[model samples]
Target: MTKKFVTLDDFLGTHFIYTYDNGWEYEWYAKNDHTVDYRIHGGMVAGRWVKDQQADIVMLVPGVYKVTWTEPTGTDVALDFMPNDNKMHGTIFFPKWVEEHPEITVTFQNEHIDLMEESREKYETYPKLVVPEFASITYVGEAGQNNESVINEAPYDGMTDDIRAGRYFDDNYQRIRK
Candidate 1:
């Protein structure tokens, strides 16, 4: 069989709730092919609307999309969304853990300030960090229907398709250096 990938233009919007095996749940919204918004209703960041996460989505198979992005907290995430089976899988690489155990996670830290400098000075680098946590996530439901996790907000208003005007930044715009 031939494998197909989702193109930017052919992309449809994505919104769903998924739960990790540990019972932490998140409501995610793929605002477009390039941006994501989510709310953590459980686990570490409950009740916060994490908006405008830059993401790259690739379709592994029909109804199965892989989304990858870096969070402002220095956390790297790769998630596979399988709506047909009502499941998702994820690997999260956290810099805080790497910061705590340098020997264990000796990999390139990308643009993350503290870890990036450490890796540069030590000359210990790899393309990507070896993720330690594998989260088995199951689809909870769609965005709105009886989901307490949904933040009930419209798509972030500050988003602009004009790349020349401004680069993609989080809702707080902290990533934008003055």
Candidate 2:
């Protein structure tokens, strides 16, 4: 299929619910061209409504699209929506640990999280899969049901750096010691 990237106007007034393999279900409402409101169904922030989160939505195929955004805590997310197949797959990059250690520069070999063999020779590194591609999530319901709640609410400003660092821990060290 030819690649075509469409604008968010195509998705405006749409609502989608997807459940990850890890059992994290999320409800996404496309309010406009730049803003999306989301609610986590099962996670640390469950039931917490994040309103007016800025997002970049692009159509990859006729009915498939890729939506991406960065959270306030420095987390990056990229999700591919496959409505025809009733599936959504994506990856979330948690940069809290890396942010704590500004001295290190982390680079991934690919979206699969494999480390490059050449990089090992250049620097002392313990390669880890920081970005894990999530399994396909089941997409439910039709779009344009107006599932919108009280929109125009305050946008989501994720956790503060220090607090987020405390909650985020890697195998090496905890960034911020409470």
Compare the candidates by TM-score and give the number of the best one.
Answer: 2
Model 1 per-residue lDDT tens digits across residues 107-163? 212224464445445553334454433344333222322222233342233222211
Candidate 1's C-alpha lDDT?
Answer: 0.51
Candidate 1 clashes between residue pairs 3 or more apart in a chain or in different chains: none
In model 1, which regions exceed 4 Å deviation?
Answer: 1-11, 97-178
* Candidate closest to the true structure, highest lDDT: 1
The residue-level lDDT of candidate 2 at 43 comes to 42
Write one digit per residue (lDDT tens) for candidate 2, span 110-168.
22122223333334333322444454433332234233432222223342222223342
User: Clashes in candidate 2: how many?
Assistant: 0
